[model samples]
Structures are given as structure tokens and as C-alpha cells.
Target: MARAPTTADAFNAVAEPRRRDILNYLALAERSVSEIVDALEMEQPSVSKHLRVLKDVGLVDARREGRQMLYRVNALAIRPLWEWTTTFERLWRHQLVKVKENAEKKTNL
Candidate 1:
């Protein structure tokens, strides 16, 4: 299947590790472009480019805060991605339960 453009959806935008990093950082608190650049140790232009994609996909929102642009995660826009990933939550829980059972049996033996 053709890969969707990063701007097409929150999932696609976050598929890039650096973009995910930006989102994770913003999840803690809103940050200016320079702050994101500093936290991620990424070049300003690269951070800006990823931020543009994230903003385009609605995963991020930006507002002018004085002279700087502050970016933050849009939780509502990210809900779809969260919902999709959580579909596997039950499956993960089941597998973890089995592992725990096996470990208990070994310890008791």
C-alpha cells in the first residue's frame, strides 16, 4: 500500500520518530520551536519541518505567544490514533497473564 503523506493523518505524522519525539515533548507541556529544538537536540529546521507536518495533521496546535510560536498536542485530534492502538490492549493483557502463570508455576516447582 502506498504510504500516506505525513500531513494526511495524525498516525502518519507521528510515524516519524522525530515527529513522535516532538509530540511526546509537547504532551508534557507546550513549547516554543526553539524549546523543542533544544529538548530533542534536533536542528531547528528539522524540528520546524516536523512541527509543520504535525500541525497540518491536526495532531498539534500552534499559537503565537509573544514573539515565539508555542506548540502543543491536540488531544482530541490524537484520539483516533489512541483508540486504534488500544484495540490491542486486551490481547496484551492476555499474553501478560499467561506469562505470569508460567512464571508462577516455575517458582512453585
Candidate 2:
């Protein structure tokens, strides 16, 4: 089967570690490309590439501010990814409970 392009959806777009890092940074506040490059210690071109992919997938929004372009995460566009991951939250909680019970049993023995 053919693999989907990173720009195809939020999932594919965020699959890249760099893209995730970009999103995390943008989560805090909107920033210019140079700000991201300096903060993340990445090359300007690389950051720009990742931002383009994220924007194409609607995971991010970019606007011209003065002479530079500022980028920010689009929370609404991330809803599907958030909803999907949350489904696993219950499983994680259940596993944690089981682990805690096992630890208590060992401690009491």
C-alpha cells in the first residue's frame, strides 16, 4: 500500500519529531521562524519546511507580521488528534491501577 504524505492529515504531519517539537513550541505562543530556529536550535530552512507541512495539514496557522511570518498552532484543527489519543487515556489509567495494586500486594506480603 502507498503511504500517505505527511501533509495528508494531522496524524501523518505530527509523526515527524521535528513537527511535534514545532507544535509544542507554538502551543506556548505564536512565534516567528527565526524565534523557532533559535529556540529549537534548528536550521531556519528546516524549521520552515516543517512549518509548511504543518500548515498544509491545518495543524498550524501562519500570518505575516511586519517583515516576518509568525506561526501558531490551530487548536481546533488538533481536536481529532486529541480525541483519538484520549481514547487511550482510559487504558493507561487502568494499567496504572493494576500496577499500583500489584506493588501494594508485594509490599504487604
How many clashing residue pairs, candidate 1?
0
What does candidate 2's lDDT look like per residue over 2-108, in tens digits? 99999989999989998899999999999999999999999999999999999998999999989999999998999998899999999999999999999999999
Q: Return the clash pairs for model 2, or none.
A: none
Off by over 4 Å in 2: none
lDDT (Cα atoms) of all candidates against the true structure:
0.90, 0.94
Instruction: Provide the TM-score for each candidate, comma-separated.
Output: 0.88, 0.91
C-alpha positional error of residue 46 in candidate 2 after TM-score superposition, expressed in Å: 0.8
Distance (Å) between predicted and true CA of 92, model 2?
Answer: 2.0
Taking the tens digit of each residue's C-alpha lDDT, what string does model 1 give over 1-109? 8977888888788789998888889999989999998889999999989989988988889999899999999989989988998999999999999999999999999
Tell me model 1's lDDT, rounded to 2 decimals. Answer: 0.90
For model 2, what is the alpha-carbon lDDT of residue 13?
95
Off by over 4 Å in 1: none
